[model samples]
Target: MEKTDVEILFEQIDNITETVQQYSNETYLDSLAVTLEVIFYQHPPEGMDEKLQEQLQNFIPQLDVSKYKTTEIRKALQLAMLKGMKGATQQQHLMTPETVALFVGYLAGKVTAGKKNLRMFDPASGTGNLVMAVLDQLETAGSVFASEVDPTLINLAVLNANLQKKEIEYFHQDSLRPFLLDPVDLVISDLPVGYYPDDIRANDFELKADEGHSYSHHLFIEQSMKYTTPGGYLIFVIPEFLFDSDQSDKLHAYLQENAHIVGVLQLPETAFKSEKNRKSILILQKKGPNTTAFNQPLLVQVPSFKETKAMDDILAQMNAWFAENMNS
Candidate 1:
């Protein structure tokens, strides 16, 4: 009996995984990992009925899976299977498609209003969802840079970019490390909170087990400002608790001293219900020394969006704010 194409592909994937595992360090692992993920997602191996399998065999070339690692290929296959098993029930809590639409709309409004030449960065880019959103709204001239610590999640993000046929630079790095290069025009990140898989030591004074080890929304905001050019923007998704915490006071003080609090959008709980987290979008402007005379912060409290109408209301307000503030 002859081996099926699926079996052959699985064998090829295994070979790639073994090759990647041969490398002791992370660099090779990261490179092969992302490539493997892209291949797996592009031609998932699981849950394909005989008809679907035959269709895929014709559509997907056998040579395409040669460049990636087997582990990454397997992981992608597993993810697809898991998602299928959970089905529609898993999607209910996910951020509504409209939420992403509103976000892109707001981003478009900003870009149209002289936020051009935009150099965007997301420090904690997860599966490249927000990064993709920004790219979809901006022009081809714009550049996006993203960093993710989790190798598996980073692979997913790279795959997402490949699926979109977009060019983005992604780094596999711990966000807490000091960036060696200069800042970009904009920094947008959805900060990780509570317990996360990739928590790193906050600083030399902190231990990895310390509560401070987790990436803080305040830290991302503050550190990101350092990388942002004066008059540039830092847009981030943060936990609501950040607004009222002692850390918030410190973050506010830092912003008062270094940047302008441009706006805050209180996202619906549904926005992050899938992740079981509460989130808010904050838009901040890095101020130049000459522009630092403003005495206070601009506080805008946006209501939660429960449906399309609510999202429309939010988009309108965000568009209005961009029109009033951003110059074309």
Candidate 2:
């Protein structure tokens, strides 16, 4: 097949990024920011100047800024920047895989697509891929909101959304607090796991005080639910160990009593292999005053889906679970 404009632009941008990466300097981030600016925007943003343009010349030899539109440039820049994050040792941001991102987003869209109105939020929306996926399917799904603490990643997310002319109600602060004034219909995230700083949590999270001090993931789950509307859906791509820990017992109990946790699908170990964590997708439907007596969630052990039969079994397990709970 002949290469399309997107394919050709991405390849050219890739070559430029590879050259830029070889320059081992403390000013790497600044260089990258300027590189993106000169390529994407005709005017340097506010304080930046033509000197920033000099930085680009060394990396991209045959600069044809006129060849691509601003939107196309932004797309290539976003792709290059994210690729750099995955490869860099220092300041690396581990993004969720595209398949997983699309899966969760598609599932949410499938449920809420035809609804008259709906809102979706992601607590830790790295690169905005998850929200973008949701928008891809549920094109009519109302507004999108997300929070990211890291300055760089948040900026990338904003740019990615804007490139496609999608508006996001973005908050640059931590998503742990009561960020949204109004509760949303759906919450979707790949929650970040690590030790949350104690002094930070010394405020309102007295409920999970101890458990949160150990792992911030617990706090994210509890806080994420707080932002959701009653009977709203909460979807997370999180570690399997999130439920296994003794500290998480309270969370498990609270979810069971308060939400109809319809599915707990153990993702194949191959999903996203990091040295420390195996992941799972938890699908939750918070109960309202009118919700019926809670239903038991389907819990299934998935296999390594190397071939046809294993993949079939995994799908079968999830389909059976969805049949019972997607309505509740």
Best by TM-score: 2
Question: Which pairs of residues collide in model 1?
Answer: 16-70, 17-70, 183-227
Residue 44 error, candidate 1, Å = 10
| Global lDDT scores for all candidate models | 0.57, 0.67
Per-residue lDDT of model 2, residues 272-327, tens digit only: 65636577888787788776543566666666656569768766766665666555
lDDT of 1 at 238: 71
RMSD per model, one decimal: 9.7, 4.2
| Residue 129 CA displacement from its true place in model 1, Å | 1.1
Instruction: Single out the weakest 10-residue window by summed lDDT for candidate 1.
Output: 87-96
**Candidate with best lDDT:** 2
TM-score of each: 0.65, 0.80
Candidate 1, 270-295: lDDT as tens digits: 65544446666777778875443323
